[model samples]
Target: MSVCVKGDTILYGSDNYLKIADAADPSNPIEIGETSVPGDIYSITVRNEYAYLADIFNGLRIIDISDPSHPTEVGHYNNIYYTRQIVVRDNYAYVACEGEGLKIINISNPMKPLEEGSYETPGRAYSVALKGNYAYLAATNSGIRVIDISDPSDPFEAGYYPTEGYAYDLTIQGFYLFVAEGAAGLRIFNISNPLNIKQIGYYDTDGLASGISVEGNHAFVNDGIDSLFLIFDVSEVYFPQETGCYKTATANWSSAVNGELAFVASDGAGLYILDCSLAPTLLQSFNIRQAETKMELSWDISSREGITGFKIYRTTNEEQPMTKTTSPTIPITASNHYEYTDNDLINGKSYTYTLAVRDSDGSESVIGERTVTYKLPNIVYLCQNRPNPFNPSTSIECTLAEPAHLNLSVYDINGKLVKT
Candidate 1:
C-alpha cells in the first residue's frame, strides 16, 4: 500500500489495484478514477502527466494520470522482478529491485523507458529516495546504501549505513536521512558525508514502522503491526518527538499533503484522508425562487461548528464582481434554515446569487450559486363607463403597466372601431 499526492488529486495503491481520489473536500474521500495493474503496487511516483509505479512482478510501469478517473498504462520495463520502490527525478527513474539492486532507466520518452544503468547492493533493496547526485536505498536487512547516479549508465555506491532493524522505507530532508526501521521504529541518520554517514537519533513507536513521509519539520510514520500512524516534530533532529497519532485497522503506507489534506494508505482499511482545516461539510443546499421583480433565496447549513455566519453575493453579469447582499452578515443560529428576499430587480433580466459560508477563522468558501431571470405578466385595467345608456356624454378610464401609444375612437355602443 502506497500513495502519491499531486494538487488535490491522490494516486493510492491497494494491493494490485491503483486508484485516484478527489480530496477537494478533505473530510470525505471520493474516488474519481481507477485501473488494474499486473503486480502488487509497492511504490508510486508522479511527474508531469504520468505516474511511475514499481510493480513487483511487472518491473516498472508508466501510467498516464492526466485523466485521473481513467488512468491507462503507457509503457513498461519487465527485465527484473521484485521491483520494490521507485523514485523519479528529471528524465530518469531510480528503481529498487530487491535482488537486482538499483536499476536506472531513462524515461525521457514516457512510452519507452530504456535501461541506462545498474548497481548491486549487499542487501535486498525495498525502497529508494533521491538527492543531488545520490540515491538512497532502504535495503531491508542491509540498511541504507547511497548510490551516486551522476553517471546514469554507470552508477556506484558512495555510502552505507546499517540499521538495527529491517529498513522498509526512507526519505531525505537536508542532510538527514529518515528511515522506517521495521521493529526498531523511526531511525534518523546524518549523511552530510555520504561515505561517513552515522545514526543521530531514533524513535521507537512500540510497533513495526514500515512507511514514512516527511514535510517541513514533521514526519508521518505508519506502523504495519499496530496499525498506528505517528506524527513527529523533527525541529530538533537529536530528539524527534511524537506530537500526535491516529490508529487505523492496518496502516502500511505514508502521507502527502494537498492544502490541509493528509493522505495515508492502510492495509485492509483502504485510503484515509484527514482534513486539517477542521471545516464542516456543507451538507444542505442553496435554492432560489423567482418572482415578479424579486427573488426568494433560501439555504441550509449542516452544522455551525466552526462557522461564524454566511454572506450572500449578487451580480447581474459574471464579468463583474458580485456585490455583498447580506447586511453585516447572517449570524449563526440554532435553526439551520436561512432565508433572504431581494426586491427591486429588473424584469426579464437574469441575476446570479452566490452563498458563501464564513468560518470563525475568517476564511470563507462559496457553497452554491444560481442564476434566474425575473419576469412579470402583462395586464391592463379599464374602469366602468360612467352614465350608462346616456345620450349626452360618458366618462371612461384605462390603465396599463408600460408606456405605449393609445388610439381611442368614440363610437356608438355597437362594438365598432374597438379592436382586441
Candidate 2:
C-alpha cells in the first residue's frame, strides 16, 4: 500500500521496488509502473515521475516512472551500509543508513545518481523526513536527530532528542515532527524551534508504533504487531488522542491518507484501501402507522470529512442497476429529518425504497434495503416512502417493521403548506 500526496500518487512493494501511481481518484488508482532492484524495499520518494528507492542490502536505486507502467532503471548508488529509508530534496537524497549513520546522494541527473557524502550518527538510523533545509533522522533507540541540510553535500547534526525507545519512522507537518517511537507510542514534537526540539505531548497505545503520516490535524499510525491502523485526533496538539482504529486484512508495515481515504500495506494481507466517508453510522429504515399518509424520516448526523446529507430514492425495477438519475435526494442537516406525503400515490401499489448518504465531496453510500408492498390505509404496513420523487405527494405505510413516531404532512416546493 502507498500514501500519496493530495496531487501525487505512490505505491511500495517488497519486491525491492516501488510503484508510482496517479491519485486523481482516491478510490480508483492508476499505476505508473514498477521500479526494480535487489534487497527488499523499505521506502520510496517520488518527485515528478522520478522515484528514489531504498533497498535494505542493495543501497539506493533510482528509476524514472514518468510512464508509470514501464518504469525503467536509470541509475543506482551502492554503499556498504544497510539502507532503510530516504527522502529527496532539491538535488540531494538523504538516506537512513543503518549502523553507519545517514548517507546523502546527489541526483541532479537521473541517469547518474552520484554519492555526495555521508554523516555518521551516534546510533542506527531507521527513517528520515525533510522540512525546509532541515532533516529529521529517526535514529533507532536514540530518538530523533535533527540535521541541517542547508549544504546538501555536507549535512551536519543540529540537535537530538531521546524519545525513550526505538524510533522506527518519523514525519513532519508545519512545525511539528511526529515520531513512531515503538513501545513508547507516538511522540509529538514542537519544532517551531528547530535547533531546540522539544516533546510537547504524546499518545501511548498497546500496539507498537511502526510507521506514521500526518495530514492537517489528523495522524495515521501503523501498529507493527497485527496490521492495525490507528487514527488519532491531533487537532489538539498538546493532548492528542486516538479516535478510531482498524485491522487491515494482513499485518501492515506502513499507512497513509489524503483526508478522504486511508491506505494500509500489509506484508501478508497485501494492500487495503478504506473509504472513511461517514463519522457515525445511520439506521437504514423507519416505519410508522397505517393512518399516517405522511411519514417523517431522519438519521444520525456525522462529522467526518466528505459528508453531505441524505437522499431518498425509489426503484420499481429491482433487477435494473440503481443510478443517480433514478434516486431523488431529500436534503437534511444535523439530523435526518424529512417529511413526505402520499395523498396522490396509489394506496395499493407495491414500491421499493432506499436511503443514500451523500458526502461533502459528492460521494454517496446508499444503505442496504428492504422492499415495501403498499396496501389499504387501515391495513397498516408502515414502511418508509419509496421513489421519493413526489411532485405533490408520496406514501408511507405502517404494520411497523421498526419503531417510528412520525408527523407526516405535505408542502409545496416553495415551503408553502398544502396539507396538514
Candidate 3:
C-alpha cells in the first residue's frame, strides 16, 4: 500500500513485507532485497541509514536500510493505536496516527524514538507532507489541515484547505501541495505561504485516486476503483490536462515516479514497472508583454529536437477564431528567448494570442492553445470631488487599476493646509 524511492533504490510494501528493487534501468527493474515486519505497512519514508515505516497497528517501525540488498529493523515505536503515514525530517518523525491525530516522534535517537508532541487533527488523518515550518495533513472529510511544526515539541493548527473530496494522500513540490482525493481525483493547492493557502487547480481522473506523485510537470495518479494509472500535465497549475493513461490488470492503489519511469503498486497483481518517457516535455512558460500599441509574446520549451518552430496566432474577439499572425519563424534549436512582437494593436482593445507548433512536414499542429493578454495597463483616475457644493463634509472618489494604499490631504478654500 506504500512505496518510496531513494536514488535508484525503490521499495514497496506487499502484505507484511517490504520489497526493494534497483531501478537504474527503469525498463527492467530488478529486485534486490526483502524484509518482513509485523503489521501492515501503510507508508514508508527513508532518510540517512534508516527507513521509517508507518504500520496500521504497529505504530512506527524503523528499519536499517543503509544496505539496499538487505534491509533490517533497527527500531520501533508501537504505543499509538494506528499510524497510517509518516514523514521523517532531521530529528523528528511526524506520524499521521489516524484518529489519534498527528504524533511528533523525536528520532534523534532512532533506536529509542520518543513522543515529543501531538496535534489533534480535525478529521481522520490519511497522509502528511512537510514543508519548511509546516506539516500538511490529508484529513479525509476535513480536507487538508496545516500543522505548524516550527515548534515540533508544541505543534498547533495553522490553517486548513477544506478539500472537495476524500483526501487520501499528499506530497509537496516547490510550494504547491498535490493531494490524491479518492473520488474527486487530484487536488492542487498553492502553499507558498502556508498560512494563506489557496486552491489553484484539480484534475478529475474519473476514478478513485488513492495515491499520487509528481515529477517535473507531470503528475502520476493511481486509480484504485477502475484499475488505472493516469498521468497529467500540471505545467499550468490552473488547468491540469490528462495527457496519458495506463490500464492495469487490477486496482492500482499507489504509485511513484523517478524521472521517466513510474512504479505502481497493484493490490493483488504485484508491482508494475512502466516507461513514462512517452509523456512529452512541453513549453515551460509563455508570457505576453505590452508596449504602447503592440504586444510581445515570449515562450520557451524543452525537447526542441523534433519540432520545426513556432507560429504566432491572434484574435481580437472570442467569437472569432484565431488567425496565424506569422509563419513558422521562431527557431528554438539553440535559442533561449523565443518571442514574436505583434504590432499595430489598438489601445483598450483586448486581443488573445494562441501558440502553435509548425511540424517538420510543414503542417501546423496545436501543441496546446493558451491565452495571455497584456491588454492594457490600468490608469489611476481621480474624479472631481463628489457633491461639489456640499456642506461641512463632502465625498471624494478615486479609482486605481490595482490595489494600493495612498494618503489623501484636504486643503481649505483659502489655500490653507488642512487635515490629511
Candidate 4:
C-alpha cells in the first residue's frame, strides 16, 4: 500500500541533542542539518510539525521543525526536576516526574506552558504511556499506576497495581496494558475496567525487557543484552506467544511506530528505522562499520531508489560496535541485485558485518544482517543499551566505521540529565 520507508534518526543529550539526517529515501540517508537543545533529550513525541521533547531536568522543549533541516526551539518548561516521560493529548501534556510524581501542563500556547495540576506517588515515576483518556505510569517499585486524564487540568488516580519488583516501561493498546516489569518480565493487564485492573498474561525473555512498542498483533520488547527483539503475539490477550525476532544495527532501547514503520532509539547508535508491513523489511543502515580485519557482508535493500553505496559495520560481541566502513558507492539500477566480496579480509578469527545501501537522493537505510569470523577483531558495536531494569548505569556500545561524535550521559531515576 505505502511506498516510502521512514527511518528514525536518533539524537540524544550526550550528542548535543541533535542527530540531523534525512532518510526520505530509504537507501541513502543524508545528513541535512543539526541543532542544539537546552537539555539532554530523553523522550520525543511529534504532533504536527512541532516535536515535544522531554529533556531530563530541562523540562519539556517545544521545537518547530516545519522544516526538518532547520529545527528551532520555540518554547520550553522547566518546572519538573526531571522530565522522565511525557504524553500529550489535545492541549494537555502529562509528564511523569521522578520525585515530582505526575505533572499536568497546559500547552495550548506552545510557547508559554502552564502547570495545571500535580500528583505524588510512593516511588519515583520513570515512564508514562497514554491511551485514550487513561495515563499509565511506571512507578518503579511503586508498580503501575493508572490515572484518569479525561480532565487534563486535574488528573485523578483511578487505580493501581503494586508489582513485586519494579515496572520500568509500558505500552497501552485497546483495553490492555503491556508492562515491562523489571524481574516480572512482560506483564499484561486488562484495563477494560479502568478503576480495577486485572493481570491477564506474561512471558519472561530471561532478561530485563525495558522498552516496548506494539503494532498490530506483535509487541516488540527490547532485551537488555543480546541483539534480539523479544517478540510476542498478543492476538490472544490471555496468552502471548514469542514470535520471530530480529535485532537492529544498534542496541534498541525505546521503540515507537506508526502502521508501516517502527522507530527505535539506540542510545549511542542513533535512530533505527524499520519497515514492518506484512513481513519486517530492513530499510537502511546508518553510522559507521569497521573491523580489526577486512570482511565480506550481504543484506537485502528495501528501497527502489538507485542504490549508490553500501555501509558496513563490525563489532566484537554484537553488544558494542566500534567501526564502520562505507563502500566505493555502487549503483543499483536493477532489482534484487547482489553485490558481494570485501576481498582484503583477514584469514582466521570472527567479525560482524552489516550492509547499508545509499540512494540517489542521499538517504541511508538501516544495517541488516550480520556475519562473524574473518580474522576477528575485538571491535565494539553498541547494541541498544539493555537490561533496562538498571539501578544506575546501563551498558552502552555502538558500531562505527570511524569514531565520530560520541558521548554517553546518565539521567536520574526520573529522566533528568545527570552527567555525560
Better of 1 and 4 by lDDT: 1
lDDT for residue 240 in candidate 2, whole number 0-100: 67
lDDT on C-alpha atoms for all candidate structures: 0.82, 0.71, 0.83, 0.67
Residue runs of model 2 more than 4 Å from their true location after superposition: 1-10, 17-32, 279-420
TM-score of each: 0.64, 0.64, 0.74, 0.61
Tens-digit per-residue lDDT, 224-336, candidate 3 = 99999998888777667676899999988788787788888888888888888888656677888776446777787765755778877788764466754686466656874
State the lDDT of candidate 1 residue by residue for 1-420, as single tens digits: 888898878898887888898877766768999998998988888998999988988899999988888899999999976998888888999999998899999999988999999999988898898888889999999989899988999999987887899999999999999999999999999888887889987888899898888876677788888888788767556657665778887655666656555687787778887654443335356788965445899987656677899888888874487764788888988888888888756556688887777889998756667788876567655657887877876777664446677765666488676532
In candidate 2, what are the lDDT values of residues 72-189, reduced to their tens digit?
A: 8888888738888888877888899887777888888878888887788888898999888788899988888888888877889888998876899999989998999888889999
Cα error, residue 2 of model 1, in Å, equals 1.8
List where candidate 1 sits over 4 angstroms from the true fold. Answer: 275-420
The list of candidate 3 runs beyond 4 A from truth reads 282-285, 289-292, 296-420
lDDT of 3: 0.83
| lDDT score, candidate 1, position 380 | 58
RMSD of 1: 19.1
Q: Cα deviation in Å at residue 404, candidate 2? A: 64
Winner of 2 and 3 under TM-score: 3
Q: Distance (Å) between predicted and true CA of 185, model 3? A: 1.5
User: What's the candidate order when arranged by decreasing lDDT?
Assistant: 3, 1, 2, 4
CA-only RMSD, every prediction = 19.1, 17.1, 12.8, 25.1
